[model samples]
Target: MTAVAAGTALLLTGCGLGGAPATAPVDTGGKVEGTITFQTMQLSPTFDDYLNATIDAFEAKYPGTTVKWTDIPSNAAARKVSADAIAGTLPDVMDLDTGTLAPLGRKGLTVDMATAAGDVKDSYVATAWQSFAFGGTGAAALPWYLNTPVLISNKAVLGKAGLGSSPDPTGYDELLTRSAQIAKATGVAGFQPTETGFANSLLTVGVPLVDETATKAVVNTPEAVAFVTKLAELYRSGGIPKDSVSAKERSEIETFSEGKTAYLESGGSRLKIIKENSPAVFGSVAVGKPLGDAAKRTWVVAHGLAVPTKSGNLPTAVAFAKFLTSAENQLALAKVSSVFPSTTASLNDPFFAVGDGDLTAAARRIAATGLRDGRTTVKPPAADAEYGATLWSAVQPAILGDVAPAQALGDAEAKLTKILQERQK
Candidate 1:
């Protein structure tokens, strides 16, 4: 537990384990009053501002109780959550991206929400609701905000490469090849993102088809491995540069704005960041759906609220979680955060109505914003939770030429097997 800011009951923390729960009831004992801490994601200042505004509103709505928060950097939130739990206390609630929630749920750290949300549950989308189930066990989190990777390219670079229009959104392989030529000729970086298993992941984003339910390791399957291998080839051929590793997703937009890179894996949210940095380039940059290759899939990641088993204040905690996600707060969040909103309505709201400018055009053209299907599914692939570390670790070395893809994955396969066995115990 963290220190409550003098007098105000606010200190951030995290906790839990999981299991299947049939249903539960909402507590209506007036209002439970106590200090509750929330974990925030290290998105941008926009998310921070939105959190502050929501906390203020929740406090005003519920007297005698208060909310406090601690912002966790994206890279560190997972580690912090795990470490905090081992210490025997957790923030009453927290924000987490998709990849981190599963392992925690396996350890029984999160409260299942199916029963917790009750009658009002119908309000959320089916796909979003399904994300709460962990390894087919308990409900772990809620859908809050989502961002999709879009195909962002430089008009001048593309035009020079004979690609028509600004975004064109016509070809992925062609773009990769053309970008390589451009980089070789102009020395401008072709892509700001280095491929890990990401190129393969991008393929799925372009055409999403992963069957985690099979209890098989598909990442090493021909389709996925080949898709990823092609990306590795591109990286080796100077089609994608090493500097891409240093490019923060946020900075990738900046690199494009400054005309340093020709192609990028960015999204609708980057529009605000790009516009802020250079309005001229922002208008010129192309925004469209990721060009389909052999398949069609789109990728999205969301961060939202969750409560800990260890929190002493469940009533206040749930209230704050509910209040924070209510339409009012969600819209408030969309305005400040500038990322894609999670609510069906917030996403449909005219971007100008929510703030200023048009998001609908882009949303429709690219279908760039959508809830993650993997999150709320009633069932998930058995080893899905333990796959990340192995999958990525296996893929990374091969992508960097430290090991052959097959060999690296072999090592990872062993570790993956170990992790699963350990978790069972």
Candidate 2:
């Protein structure tokens, strides 16, 4: 069966092999007073004061309700959440991204926020709200904060390469050419895509990682192959870092901070770190739109709140999730961080709509503009992550000259097909 079909069957039979209760419809109305544990990904300690204050406000708004919030480190979050889900101890409300929600959604572990969200649906950005709808399922999460990609440049290095003040790349080809020029002229890598995971790179350029329905691989298309080839060429030409094949987004940020790269692909939120770690580079920093082909569209990374279907306090949990994602609360979080709020009402606040004379404000405005226009990349089923990891691992050999791009993609496709077959069983 297709993954979606399998998921449907699984849900119909009760969400688990042990006969856990079937998924429940969201309950948005009625009295809501109970303790709900909220699991977040790395929002603690640093944002503790802000979060605590918000929780306090929530408690004050809904008397007799207690919110116990905990944050799991991002690196180990997936495994931790898996363990929790298996133990039937998932938090009542969860802060989740698209990738993490895929398996949960498939298992029918989350509430259908579309029904639960009520009038609040119109409060959130359309794209953000739409992102959490998995496999044609109704939205299972309430959109919260967003991070959108932008092309950040070191003006000094660009000037040294003879690229004009704005050095905005028109497309991937232009990006590669400019990167080669910058490397040759200034001895600095020309560019780095914000998310260095190869699959993510393809997604940024509007290449779908798998066929629609998530049943098979589609990465061997002419456009995708050309993208992979250009990336391999860039790596070979010294325009991309040697270690970048396995690099994460933070690595690119570090390279840019250290002044080792001319163009750093990252979100506007990085401006704070750049200003703190490399004040001089920060002075030379210029933000531009993300580069892509005609299919070029900006990417928005969003984190939202979800309630597990098995939660005993379904009404309370759904209520708390909505409370946390409400426009007032969302804007409160946005005021204290570089991340943009997901709600249209929050985005319309003077805080996001107007830019001050400062660089941070300008950066925020640029990111906000991008978020308003960008599309959120759809993550496939849980198995798609495995497929992506395999693809990333397999492509490095091709990029490093160990194999041809076509051969590498073909092998990856075959492995993905095998995975799909196994899922059918």
Candidate 3:
């Protein structure tokens, strides 16, 4: 999940095992009066005033209702949520990403937002709304904030490598070609394919992670083999870093900041870090659309509000969630933070359509446009870390030249098939 304020990238660890069976849908009863505990992840101190004011407005709008707000540190949030869920003490309204909410929805710990508040379905972006649907359950959360990746390149590095200051590659193949040119000319890696564990790399290149039924893995196709083979070749030619094949997002950013790599693909909020840490590289930065297949789709990270089915006041909890994600409230939050709003009306605000000609502003504008076609990339059933790790572990050996790409993908397919079967059973 991406942090709303800092755009800090966090890995989606796999879900927990063993939970009580599904419960009946939450009954709101049309009375929005009661006290409900609301929990958010790492939005304090900086966003305290905005959140408090929002809460105050919510309280004033619906008299006799109170919101008790609590903020959890990002590092401890998942652990705390898991513990609370096991204890049946989850907050009535909680902040979560689809990655975190899906598992809970599978266990019926979360309210089906579509059933509880389906009338507002058309208010959100179709893709953002659908992201929360999982395990045959309707939408499990109300979409809040969102972000998408943009390609940030250091023009100085590109110019030094004879690629000119404004090098633009339309897709992955051209990106690889440019990467090789930069490495050959400047002896610096041109790109660092940050190990996402997820099959984002494959997805960008038009490879599907699974079949339509999602009961079988289909990533062992010829296109997948060809892409893996290219990655192996890039690694052998010093066009990409050795450690990068297993490195995290922080390492990728560090390499680009230090001028060891020419391009960094990340959220627009990350430009703040680059400007703070490496003004020299930041000065020469150019923003571009994310490189991908014909769909031109980019990866989106969304944060949403989920109401636990066991909430003491389902009606009030659900009402608060709706109020918090309202177009007006979401746009207000977007004005004060780096995150984008998940609501369709919020996105249409004039703020997203303009840029100030600065790199960061340009990135925001580009990212906003990207979000129109944006998606979470990997959908449920295969969205968990275990599934991603299975793909990565099988393909890593191929990237390291320890096995042929086809053979590695075959192994991955078999493993994924078995895992999916087990999950279905």
Alpha carbon lDDT of each predicted model:
0.55, 0.70, 0.77
Preferred candidate (lDDT higher): 1 or 2 = 2
State the lDDT of candidate 3 residue by residue for 332-399, as single tens digits.
99899988888878878888888778777777777776665553353433545667767888888898
lDDT for model 1: 0.55
Model 3 residue runs over 4 Å out of place are: 1-20, 165-167, 210-218, 246-250, 373-390, 414-425
lDDT of 2 by residue, 1-425 (tens): 00111222222223232233336565556678989898888887878998898889889988999999998776556666666777889899988776666557644578888887766898777778876776545787888888766678888888987885644885577788888888888778886643334565676666666665555776777777787788778777788777666454346777888888888666777788888998988889887666532343555656778888778787788888888888898888888887888887777777766656676676677666655554444434433345656677767777777788888888877876666544333
Q: After superposition, how far is residue 302 of candidate 3 from its true place, in Å?
A: 1.4
Question: Which of the numbered candidates is closest to the native, going by highest TM-score?
Answer: 3
2 or 3: which has the higher lDDT?
3
Candidate 2: 10-residue stretch with minimal lDDT: 1-10
Quote the positional error of residue 58 for candidate 1 in Å. 2.8
The Cα RMSD of model 3 versus the native structure comes to 3.8
* Model 2: how far residue 185 lies from native, Å: 3.6
